[model samples]
Target: MKNLLILSLLYITLQANAQGLNERVIKLTDQLDSIGVATFEANYSHGLRTEYIVTVSCELYDDSPAPIKYQDQQGNILSVTPEQDKRIRDLWRRSHESYDLIRSTSRLLAEEGTECYIWESHRNGIDSLLYSVALRDFTNQQDKTYMPDLSTNPEWSKYGGAKEGFILKANPSRFLPNNDMEAYKKNRFQPKSEISFTYRLTVEEEDEDTVYYVDYKEFAGMIDKVLQTDGVKSHPILITHDKGAKVEDFKSEIISCDITHPDLDGETHGTVYEIETAELANTLRRLLSAEIGNYVDRHRNLNYLYRPLQDYSGDMRGMFSSNNWVIRTEFHTKHWYTFDKNLSCRVLLHHVGSKAYVLVLESVNDFWLPKDWHKLKSWKNGVKEYLYLQL
Candidate 1:
């Protein structure tokens, strides 16, 4: 009974924490919407003749700090006293803040001619909570000086990533055509634009980042309340062994999953289920999608540039041993030309003699694979299948 009571209390605390996170997200969204409106007005006041679009992408990373430990110059580790530990925890909790504004851009896509303009700006050196309040004050109090009108800056949006304000006017625009500007203008403030928000909680013991919440349509509505322009999706994508494939065509493909296990007879293949109806298939798809999205976003945001994979050769037999369940998935794109566009991803579910299982996922698709793949599991020497989910 005592254990049950403790478990119930723990569950309640977790629920409360989740609720608090949602509240924070809502408050931040509201603050961002206000800033976005002010920014749009600020840009328009400076003669933006074409349709204006604002793309505001914000991310909050909440890291739960580990217990503090002291290390001396002699390389000896020491533990803090109870009182010291409490004080340290309090300080860490107070100092650590979440909510980072990734990038906020207000753009003007040319309506007819080959001209485009953009005002990209971001609040620096402030956490989301403080920035939200401070920016509100700045926008309301400063009025004309809320944000610089960089539309005249000669830099011309050359600085990659939206960290500062700059007006980029291009002749014969090389990017996406402004043909849809009218449609976007019509749909502006409609909240029908595509937007995605993902929340990931990394539990210390799991050592894996798990996406706790993901919403698209609803959050877009919240943002559209202020921007009043067709929304833009902020997720990042890499060419990754391009294979001369288009993103639109690649996303429609499905994954073929096969799990193989050893039986007394010899070897038994796990039953494959229909992806649309099977719970396991759905879970795998969701996990893969979230992982890929997060991975691409992290690399893109950090400006880590790398060449696409040209070729790779490695053996993958040892990781798919008889003792563990080997999960093999093949991603197939629509048949084009004589070559087959197929990629394989293999996962190992190691059984620790009971219900405890360790999962290791790998792929030759270098874009999908992490540099620290070995850190995910102990048995790290074997070649693993590559799994990349475009969706």
Candidate 2:
């Protein structure tokens, strides 16, 4: 009787949550229509039973674009800019259009069991925005009575499946020497490329010669350009890893020298500097274009295994932490019989530990458009190397 009561209560709770979600959606759709949202999509999963994962595409209504707004995972009004709106739209469009191709090639239903709602605006003078949302509902399998006591945490569990496990697990042996197999494998799956363009700057400091591995080559150059440019001081904002510090105002001062890892909870607890000026943001984007192109070419067909766009989303969502600096860009390419519409490039500089400073330039393809749960895979893949970087 107790067990029955418990199960009944659980069902009631789920039903209530589902109803609440629907109500929220109704409210959100009403709110979105006023702000020029052309199309809105919300995805709900069993695990995340409350709020829906939202993606929207917008068109300029009048001479000026309406303010695009939506909710985060926690259902708070997510902070986003016009650029982010466009990026999200483009990503969703590509993912929606090529979803079948991804499934046929990768052999996984990216959205296995989820309820989806899609709304398109029919406001006058606006070209009817078009989009498709695929829905599937798979009944949960019965729990197995017999289970294997795999005592230790299975390393393979971290990957999506056999293919991702194999591709991501394969060591980057080409870069490291064969004789040092242990060391090579230990640092193989770093967030950035195994190859680096090292520069030893002549410093006047008497401290222990700290070694910092920067993820991307472009980071140093971008920072240098930002510092050199005039009028930047007028719009300066301070970025810091200190959570207690207030960033309510912008001044011509930057705090914090280098970014370090997060605490036990994986929270950076830091304040970021938004690129308030178009000039600086555009400069970074322009510089990143060439480098991202090079990365796409080098990785080529292997992009299917190292989906970078998804990785960039992970970075943007803070699945990985590096305090003050994080930049994400997307690219598309068709070359050598390989066509990828969403390639991701994420950049950051991290203070790994007391010993070294590492910069990360992340470039990968969005081969598998896995669900939100897979965001941490990038962080997990490089945890060992990240720890080594700290050492």
Candidate 3:
């Protein structure tokens, strides 16, 4: 009778949470529409009896060509320059025309479920955005049998300290090595390539928060073995963790090294190391900077900060046009054409401790299109690389 009562109470709690989620989705949709979103689609389904999954997509209206007076540093309308209008139009012509698709699927499981989202623009290429969210059920009011054990799994074991909290996992495929150099050279444009990889990590709950860590070195070593036979470039690596965690709780460092012809462009070369508490942030920052530097020359753009994995709805909205003029706005921020013009390629780095992964999310593909072709091509060529040092 006691167990029956407990189960009934748990059902009520889950129902309430699901209803709350529905409300949240409604609000989110409204927010997108207010920002000039034109089309939106979503799906919600039950995973297990107590778990669910939600997916969302929105097509935003673009207003890049709207004319406005230029403002000076003092916030004064310095002049009504038509130059801005022309610039906006030029950008629209060169800009890829396609839907900016972002897909985020959330899974609410027992113990603490996981939610992740990927944001990628069709104009940017087929590569999608990837992010994750984790939750913890503290009430013990949920199902008693639903508790997740982190010790048995090697991935969960790394994050033993986060046993009580939730650990969100991002996609590791975003940071693999690129293997399409020859295709790019032949086409003089970015080549679209598919990426596939497996991720196995552990999470532990601690106090009120969940602490999750990955043995990047081990993962990198695995990648090294796979790429040893191929001519892979020494691209910088990237691994993403949740946004809220304090860096002080983690440590990371390169502890070992190996090389088989380090001078070769695609030769396997790197160091192996560990990341413990406190050093997570600094190490991540350094690794990201190096990775970004390879694509965007640091000497050319000092303002470049590590790119965070953001949802697509926030960035790739539709382009707005009037009287043969078009403008592109990302997340409501007007990006200067110079940024794209100067861009050699857009790379996504997925960092996992001392071992990092790098992938070319998008690259220049101007020469691939026919001169007279009116329509834009949706795919391009790029490679994802996994790196680790031999101990």
Top-lDDT candidate index: 2
Task: Give a tens-digit lDDT track for model 1, residues 227-250.
Answer: 221221111111122333222333
Please list the C-alpha lDDT of all candidates, in the order they appear: 0.26, 0.28, 0.27
Tell me model 3's lDDT, rounded to 2 decimals: 0.27
lDDT of 3 by residue, 297-360 (tens): 2122122222211122221111111110100001101232222221112222333433333332
Look at candidate 2 and tell me the lDDT of residue 95.
Answer: 31
lDDT of 1: 0.26
Task: Kindly report which residue stretches of model 1 are placed more than 4 angstroms away from their true locations once superposed.
Answer: 1-22, 26-176, 179-361, 364-391
Instruction: Supply the TM-score for candidate 3.
Output: 0.20
**Candidates by lDDT, descending order:** 2, 3, 1
Instruction: Give the lowest summed-lDDT range of ten residues in model 1.
Output: 39-48
Candidate 2 regions exceeding 4 Å error are: 1-95, 108-222, 234-280, 288-391
C-alpha lDDT (0 to 100) for residue 98 of candidate 3: 18
Task: Compose the digit string of candidate 2's lDDT tens values, residues 174-259.
Answer: 44454344553343221111111000111111233222212334443444443344333212111122233222222322232221
In TM-score terms, which candidate is top?
2
